[model samples]
Target: MKAGWTSKPLEDACTFINGLWKGDKDPLKTVGVIRNTNFTKDGALDDTDIAFIEVEVKKFDKRKLFAGDIILEKSGGGPKQAVGRVVLFDKPEGDYSFSNFTAAIRVKSPDELDAKYLHKFLHWTYLSGVTEGMQSNSTGIRNLDGDKYKAIQVSYPSIGNQRRIVTLLDEAFADIATAKANAEKNLQNAGALFQSQLTTLFNRRAKRATHTTLGQATGGIFTGPFGSLLHKQDYIENGIPLVNPAHISQNGIEPDDRKTVSGETAKRLANYIMRTGDIVIGRRGEMGRCALVTDAEDGWLCGTGSFFIKPSSRCDAGYLVHLLRSDQCKQQLENIAGGAVMPNLSNTDLSNFALELPPVEDQKQIVAEIEEAKESVERLKSIYRQKLTALDDLKKSLLHQAFSGQLTQ
Candidate 1:
């Protein structure tokens, strides 16, 4: 500890005010409400996607926000994100009010405690997992223990030292943010470069090669069993694995043994069973997403949310998978997809889709070339991703030092 420094509970230094939530109302007359969705991943307030609700003017007056007020996300976080994420209000425009999922914290004595410093300390505590530890989960929704959160202690130096610390942190974090942005851009560029290569290869091939409908080139195409035939109740803990759209990733099919059907159920839906060399395309969301079934995934029961393409000897299964994943094919598939609420691809749509057909030998060569390029791009992506992770760790370290008075030394 540093000389003249003291530790005290947060409640002693600040007053906490719970937020409000007005019920549904007409959009024309409703007031804008800032909910947890308004919170950015960087601990800053995001005004985009603000919700609105109708409330009496009298009730609205009490929940109005002001400059320098810190908003704490007291509820509604998931397994990946923890509750108690704090964001400083810089006095955004309009008659802004907060939702019941959040609370506002105002310092009791500004002379003794700086609002910015307190916000940074709380952010530090959140990054340190202190806030996450104080969370309780019920029915999959995580809620912060407000009483315990307010009671948590924080140590600080004198006001002069606090200002200096905050200034140093502000400068350091700004640099860290720039570095993180660059790393993220580079990561994205690596992926884009790989996609560009894939597009160019396919584009050039399309120019010289003969084109044919997907059905003409494939052995057969079929969708999985209808929802009425196979219900969620049919899923068994230990049975035939079911491959859904979620199971198909860019990498390949990721089979979940837990999401399975009994042998009898699988037999009943035998016509929908996928075999080795079959190309599985998602029928619902992310219409372009497709994966090739390897020997390991053969005989898996295809879920209702997918389509199976049994490739003929004329087309390589791996090449077909890569073709469907490309931007060109994705755009075409998306065009024919039905339903505004949930876009989907029907069997007729898949069978009629035009595809460039090169020689079987050429298809193998193209797949090999793309695979090699993908490996290089993935390596670059991994390096940039590691740098991003390191930058986050660096910020956490700086926060720990600033709060513990090590930075002052």
Candidate 2:
């Protein structure tokens, strides 16, 4: 602790009030309500989607949020995120109350502890992963342990020093946030550049290109076995992997061993087995998700949500995979897509998917050029992504220093 600093339980420094429950009742006025969605990952409030709900007058009077109050997430977290995240409410007093999944923390004495100081400290605790231990889970929703959270010992110097620390953090964090935003933008631009190259290349070729359906270009289009033919009971922990739509990412296959079938089942579904040089394309969900089957996944079974295409002497497998994932192809697939809830691609539609096909040799050349462009884009993205990660680490380090009484005056 610093020389003039004092420490005490958070409950002693602030008053905690549970949020309001939007229950079934009559005779109430509608007001904007802050839900967990209003809280951003960076401990900031996102009020754009606030829900306006009717609340009892008495409940609103007791649960309404005020400026400088810290909103704490008491419930609703996922496997990767933890409950107990705190965001400061700097908005002016309004008819706003937090959801039942949250709680309000009001400073008991502004003369001793600054609200921003406490909010920053609590935010630091969350960023440093201190709150991960102060949580429990039930029925898929993570709940913060209120007893353990309020009992947290918050150490701070005098009010003057505390405000100084907050000011330092605010300035430093603002700069860091700006840098992070730039890095993220650069990263996105890198990917966009690659996509733009593909779109331009394909569009240019389409102008003076010979057109043909995928069925005429490829040897055959084989859909996976029906769900009735392959039961969930056939899945095994370690066996032949299934190339489901989820496994197809970034023009590559990422199979899950847990979502695999036994060798016997794979043999029974041998007709759906994808061989080397074959193209596996998703038939359900998001369109344009496809990957070329390599030697690594030569014998993997095509999942029910996907189908495989055999490249004939006419089409280059590499070129076909890239073409299928391009923006033009995605737009075409969307045109002939079925099912409104979950758009699906029928085998007939895929087989009859129209495309401007170049000569096999020219296709290979275009594939080489596109791959080279992709490599350059990936390298640029890597640098920007690393910068973003470093910025995040810097923020975490700053939080650690601030809480440890290491911030300069």
Candidate 3:
């Protein structure tokens, strides 16, 4: 809509080539093929996991990719991600082609339409939600409507002006990318600092502390009720909360009210009820996922896939929770865990596991220090995460300005 800029259908500006597919043939040839998985979220080819598969010779000849070609994802998108992502094929002309789920777009005339400029415009459209209306879902996979995508209105200035816009965008995006990377690294450092504190504080005290098996330090390990003992029919709305593995998060219990049982069912499973200061830990799948039970969750029943530990007077519950969640303990448990499909912990193995126990007072002090360090680390992570989000927003805003002919002049 800017002065002297003309708008035309994308189909008129470029020729679209449907991608290649492997066909049944006696003799075959292998070539590097780019699939949607090779497409990065940043609209670039990853090239690290390109598939080398055999396809019909004739199909490969017509669909092979070249430098300056734009590969468009016409299918294969999730519920959270939209279809119609376009990535620039910057690699040299080689024996490479895209999958059938994608297509290649080549500018018909470089003199009139700049390929880079067109690719940028399409990228902007996808980011701006303009292509959301141009997609439909089938069999849980989102597909871009080819006819609608071809009819997309692309507004552009002269080739000279388009090249100038591309130059400006390229430089600006490079700087933004650097800033985002720094923010991300800072976020990682924030988390690493907390983990370091846990490792250092625990490992340092562990050297001087008396060692004992978990069975000697705790009252007893109570495994959750088996699936046969707790039937699905026992679960009801607005009933006693059950502390399942999913409910254990960030060193604390976060029970889902929907995953509850009736008072009668809780009474029947009273042996599995958690007490205040008890530690609920996941016994299956991911290791080191454990939480401290608060006063509010004292009477909660431990659901299947978890084990509750009641710390004796000698061991501090908070200290024991942190120890169970530590990387060292996780690795130890993984070594003994068993299951054909998913790793699981046995009560006998967990009880026999050796642990370094500091005096109750010393354990509480370490827990307090860790709690303090966690607060500072969380603050730093929040700040860096905000910066990364702002950088993404800025990139989208600049793209909106560029395609609207407001980037320059």
Candidate 4:
């Protein structure tokens, strides 16, 4: 429960300043940007990946921003995901302006509520209850304005309590950050070690390694593409997902932003359907590298630039994925792709490449070990991610209490 603190209408606490919520018409070749991408996940502003737009700032005077003004992303990414992301402008130590799609909230009533505390609080739940109630302006764009934000009901214990809560949150989240950083670093190092191990295992016995095409090592290798029926017109920002070589990775597949195609398109392209245990080998640009499709992604298709491999009973899919991603196979792949602007390999060409068939037991053992190690690394990542999430929730909980005046002794 929140601390029994007095409450104030948001309208009585802050001033909302917003400019044109339109995309640039006559863009400038150079400009300053106030984008949410510049903001890091930890609530700090980072501009390393920002893009410039054409604009003459002198003409868009009201578009400027100032210190203590909190900027909110009106629309971004997917629904229920990127909406309501908040960024407080505390950098450049000077004036700036919000983007056309963003809104800025500035406090004029410093007496009623602490602006810093409110910034923290608003960020804590800007997407909480408010996001669900928001109506999308377009298929995926949702706009959040000052009026809705100001109507947000908030209560705090006191300014002193709010500060204490913020302090506690900062300390706890800092610890979580350090832990997460270390965990992620360890994951990277472990993955590298695994890759190196695979390299040594195969390259060491190069002379003894018998060469065979991917087709010889497997039952058959075939290309994916439900016959170009999934044309460009059927693709969309929303719908059934299709995974191409770009979607596959050494670590694993990530379908977070996987491309979509219409249901009709998918039906026509049904031949590309990925089975639970299907192993996909890249055929274009760095061909022969592979990734396995798991039960979680049975619905998706192994789209273009990918070849599906169904190995004989002698070959293990897990072992093959690791081997394909290894350096030896990469060399073979490069041999074919040599000196080409686009490294592309066909299924017939891939069938000519080969490697030793380790005993089934050895293959099983190696796959088991790799799986165990990867699971451990993923577990470590999960723990750290949870810790980070909890720390954030704790800060919000404390904010709820501190303003309610219950956090004090």
What would the TM-score be for candidate 1 when compared with the true structure?
Answer: 0.94
lDDT of each: 0.86, 0.89, 0.88, 0.67
Weakest lDDT window of 10 consecutive positions for candidate 3: 21-30
The best-first sequence of candidates by lDDT reads: 2, 3, 1, 4
What are the C-alpha RMSDs, in order, of all predicted structures? 2.5, 1.8, 2.8, 5.7
TM-score, every prediction: 0.94, 0.95, 0.89, 0.72
Q: Per-residue lDDT for 70 in model 1? A: 87
Question: Per-residue lDDT of 48-106 in model 1, one digit per residue for the tens?
Answer: 78786776566567777776778999888897888989998876567777888899898
Task: Give me the displacement of residue 292 in model 2, in angstroms.
Answer: 1.0
| CA deviation > 4 Å runs, candidate 3 | 229-243, 254-270, 295-300, 338-341
Q: Rate residue 18 of model 1 by lDDT.
A: 81
Model 3: lDDT of residue 236: 86
Model 4, span 1-409: residue lDDT tens: 3545766667766666664343555543244567767656555557676555555545356666666677777766364465667777766554456676667777776565666677777766653455546535666566665466677776765667766766765676677677767766765676676667666654554554455656777777778884455566667866777777777887677653537877777787777777777787777776656788787777777778788876577778888887877766788788876657778886767777766766666677777776766677667667756765665676567655554555565
Q: Model 4 Cα displacement at 237 (Å)? A: 17
Better of 3 and 4 by TM-score: 3
lDDT of 2 by residue, 217-316 (tens): 9998999888898888999987999998999999499999898998888888888989999999999898999999999999999999998999799999
lDDT by residue (286-326, candidate 3, tens digit) is 88899888888889999899999987998998888888888
